[model samples]
Target chain A: MISVTALTVSRGERLLFRDLSFHVASGEAVALTGANGAGKTSLLRTLAGFIRPDAGTVTFSAADPAEARAGHLHWLGHLDGLKTGRRAREELAFQARWAGADADGIAAAVDVLALEPLLDLEVRKLSAGQRRRLAFARVIAAPRPLWLLDEPFAPLDARWRAALGLMMQAHLDKGGAILAAVHDPLPVAARALDIGAGR
Target chain B: MILFRRELALAWSGGGGPLLACGFFLCLTVLIPLAAGGDPAGLRPIAGGVAWLALALSSILSLERLFERDLEDGALDLIALGPAPLELVVLAKAKAQWLAVGVPLALTAPVAAITLGLPPAQAPLVLLSALVGSLGFALTGALGAALALGSKRGGLLIAVVVLPLFIPPVVFGAGALERATNGLDPAPALAFLAAWVLFAAVVTPFAGAAAIRNAQG
Candidate 1:
């Protein structure tokens, strides 16, 4: 579903990676592992089109660039991007509508993530793990063809992490692809791409 | 459509934005007379100018929060990847803010003029000219907020960036009221103020979106 060639990413005067290449096909998952400050997040961001590469092209073979960016991919970053003043349910529903999800999709995501109990609580009042769970639910709420997760497992307990692994496996079972930046191993089988090796 | 409503709800979530801007205008109007030694005759000639200046300054109060909060909280990244063009997103945010904050300042301009000792006969012109003028200020202020998105001192930077852009509208809006009070034709000045707003409405979105992209990078 995605491909890149000779990708070079730099931060200011420092070079993070050079001459990098990788691909993720449907029903596949690519685990990105590297040392701290090894540009895993930067690479995910580059693929998500948030940062322009120093040199290379990111091609989504089946769709135009704009369409691929608009609804085809789902991104989970560190901040969760949630409003503290709103309830968990309100936040999830807004994201669902924004991503073109219907009622059943939202319901299934809530059920899978076990978020029904915390839906009425405002984001500010939720614990860190609960917030992380809610953020992941946003992705499940509107299942995109491609998922770009930057450090998706942080702040979760063992059970939630295992649940996330199961969720990722189910997504792959449904022919979805995932590219995740992580320090720990992913739950499903994935081809590991170590960014620090070539440097 | 969801984003627009979301912006409006966010703006009013804390409380009513218009109520505070209106209160700010009232306090500013009352201050001008005291600053001028409480002479009614002395305050009349510059009442329109004082009212326009207050409106311009008050509009800046809410602008620094426009894109800064979203940028800090990671919302900008998801918003950038959304289906709508970034320019439309920027426009929706600015328009929602104007409805929440700018309209009340304009609605209360005539009261400020009255507090500053302007004759009641010219109240309608004061209100109309200020209405169009504040929209111009809101558009420019949105652009300025985007430009200063991640700066260390974004609030001060916004004030510096937008105050210069506000000069033409302030001159035209204050001039329209000045002409009406002097019993001269106010059409040309009011027309100029409206023209400035129309121009700003067209150009601000592109510039604001570009600034947002730059800040995100």
Candidate 2:
């Protein structure tokens, strides 16, 4: 679904990764593993078109870069990206409209994440696990083909982690692709790529 | 459509932006009198000018957040990933901000002008100029904010970048008010002010979008 060739990413004076290449196909999940500061997030950002690469190209085999960018991927970065002052429901609705998701998508995401009771509260008041779950819901909110996740399961407890695993399995079953940076084991069977080793 | 509503809600929320700008506008009107002593003649002459300056300065306060906040929260990335052109997103945000902050500030101008001893007859022109000038301010200010997007000193940088751009509007607006108050023809100055707004409106979206796209790295 997504491919990169001869990708090199650097942060200021330090080089994070060099001459990297990888691909994730439909119905596949790639677990990007690396130690801290090993360019895991950088790779995800680069593929998601957030960071410009120092070298090489990231392309979709079936579509143009712009189409791949517009609605093909859902990125869950380090920050939850929720507005602290806005209510949870309001934030989700805003994102839904922007992401071109419909009412059913929003409701399914809210239900899967079990966010019904938390809808009225401001985002700032939500706990860490809840916050992470709220962000995770975006993947479900819009059924995008690609997901660029940075530490996808970091803040959730075991149960929520399991729920996330189930969601990933379901998404993969539906022919979606995932590129996630993980520090721990993911319940879904994934092809692991260690960024540090590639470096 | 959704982006506009969300921007408006965020701007007007508690401790958000628009109300704070109005408060700042009121403070400037109140303080100038105390600073200048109780000389009605001197105060009346400069009232329009002081209001123009305050409006320009207060406009800076909100512009800093126009893009910076979204950039920080990762929302900018999401917006960029959307189907809409980034230029339209930049323009929509500035328009929403103007509706939230500029409209309220413009509406409050006549009252603020009255408090600053601007002749009651000049209040209408003061209000008109404020409305037009704010459109210029909002557009130019968005460009400045986009330019200073990732800077550590974003607020100061935006002020420095935007304040200079504000001068033309301030000059034209104040000229319109002064001429009208003096019972002279203010038509030429008003025309210039209107032209400046249209110019800012056209230039900002393209320039601001490029600045924002460059900063994403």
Candidate 3:
């Protein structure tokens, strides 16, 4: 579980949000709803420890800030993080191992994502939805308590989008926490947090 | 270990690998005699200096991408989230750079030195100094690369930041070869080169990690 108190973040001379406070408890998904230029991604990054907040505190109940960042969460940002030169299998294996997943975990992820046929191709050769699926596969391969997703379903087609919704439901069922930044409705049930609305 | 292996593979297969640096190094060495006139006697005195200069420049060739690629592709974010501390990740990357880029250039340095009229008797010292000096280059180069991440003209920024850091190793490595060429004791200079490498190894990981974290924000 994560909590933010009086979180204020600014970029350059512009203030994105101020005095924002929210928390996502276990088995919950908090969809961040706001217009572009709002502090949704910034909030996620702040919690993930990528951005230092101008003012406020983000705390994880189970672990210290550093430990929570290092091993407790999955961050799926806009970029897929796959190396263009690497084979899909190579990328998946490396990411899975890097996340401390066992071989069985990787096998299960491959099965769920239907990644077997695309394993040998270079990442650049994969289609957009395929690449997005590959990106989401790492999250499945490694079980983390929290996922800080920025537009989790952006590039996927309808079928994959629905599939990911089901996956999110399963994750919530297992007591994981999610803080996602999105423009559209999340496939599963989620409490909406409107950033910058007070301002 | 997986991170190290992945870095090494990326260094080798992507962005022309060690081949590009080696080619740039060889070309620089070859151009020296042509530009200065083909007089072995004239070139011999500065051969060590020229080779060291070429080595320094070649080391800079691949540094621009060391951290830039990861940052641009978002791998850096995930890397920071991994179980290893960010400092360890920086250390692994620098170590992999030494193995991938530094070692190949070190192996090719003796040949370049000898071709530039360095005495074959001093070839072994040239090889040893280059081996150690390139380690310094790789370590400091990673720091420079990390510092220049997300900048508009990152390659230029990396060169500006890294070339100054190269001065110590270049001085020590070239000084070692010069001493040997003059039939003096080269041990002290070689020791200096090793010390520079140790200093770089000590300072780069923490500094580079900080730079990386700053870039993330």
Candidate 4:
């Protein structure tokens, strides 16, 4: 299970979220809904160990989030963050290698994302939707137990969104958990945690 | 080792700026002799200095790419999440930069030496000292690269930050070559270069890694 207890996140003297507590057990999908500047991404970053909370702790049962990063959690942020000048295959290979995923795992991910035709193309040249798809494909490439995605569907088209829904379902079915921040309604049945402005 | 190999691959692919810097190094080496009238005696005295300056300039040119792309594309976050400590990641990156830019420059020192009319006996020592000294340059440059990752005019910013740090290597490398030409052993100069490399190998990575984390925060 992934848990955030009594978390208080602040940015430069302003508290974004105070005493925020939450948990997503295995096979659960949790959506973070919030107004503009409601600290959704900050909350996600804190959970992913990318940002330290002003107070409280984020715990991963299997291991400390910092120590077992590859095994325990995966974070897909607002930026598609693809290496701009690299071909899709090279990017996938590099990311998979960094995540400790195997060659077979990478191949399977490419096949699942239907990126065979685009595999040889440079990422910078790909459209935004294609880039998002490629970023989404990384989740499949390295199957971590917990996923924290910021705006996973922002740049995806309807078809890709549906495909991503299925992917999320598959992940949840396999005993993985997801915490995603989204403005649009997700295809999956997810519990919504709303963060309004000044709350 | 795998991380180092990945960095090497990224640099060697030349899609980034390192390849252009190599070309710049080559061009500068050839241009200086032509501009200086090809006076072998005068050129011989300053060959190591000229080469060291060229290496430093080219290195500064390529330093921005060290962490900029990764920071922009989110690879920096992923790397921070890797099992290897961030310090190791910085070291690996510095090593890769050295291999791509420094090692190539060192290997081709003979060409620069010949162009500058350096004595044959001094060429090897100049190359060896440069190889050692460039390791320090790469490490120190990486720290500046990390600090300037998201800054405006990042390339210029790194140069501004790293040029002052280049003094020690420039002095030692040039001094070693000068001593070699005078028929005196340059053991002290070479030892100083080695010491600088060792010191950077230990500490610069921590500074770089801290800078990266701070930038991300």
Q: Residues B22-112, candidate 3: write the lDDT tens digits.
A: 9999999889899998888899898999999999999998888889999999899989999899889998999899899999999999999
lDDT of 4 by residue, B97-198 (tens): 998888877766666765677777677786788788878889989988988978989988898899998988888888888788788899998999888888
Off by over 4 Å in 1: none
Clashing pairs in model 2, backbone N/Cα/C closer than 3 A: none
- Chain B TM-score, model 3, reads 0.98
Local error of candidate 3 at A105, Å?
A: 0.4
| Residue B128 displacement in candidate 1 (angstroms) | 2.0
Give TM per candidate: 0.97, 0.96, 0.99, 0.92
Question: Lowest lDDT 10-mer window, candidate 2 chain B?
Answer: B10-19
lDDT against the true structure, each candidate: 0.88, 0.87, 0.91, 0.82
Quote the positional error of residue A139 for candidate 3 in Å.
Answer: 0.6
- Candidate number of the best lDDT: 3
Docking class of 2: medium
The best-first sequence of candidates by lDDT reads: 3, 1, 2, 4
lDDT of 3 at A29: 97
Candidate numbers, best TM-score first, in rank order = 3, 1, 2, 4
Query: Per-prediction DockQ scores?
Result: 0.72, 0.64, 0.88, 0.52
Interface RMSD to the true structure, each candidate: 1.1, 1.5, 0.6, 1.9
TM-score for predicted model 2 compared with the true structure: 0.96
lDDT of 3 by residue, A1-199 (tens): 9999998888778888888888889999999999887888888888999998899899998899999888889999988889988999999998888988989999999999899999999999999889989988889999999999999889899999998898899999999999999999999899999996934
Give the higher-lDDT candidate: 2 or 3: 3
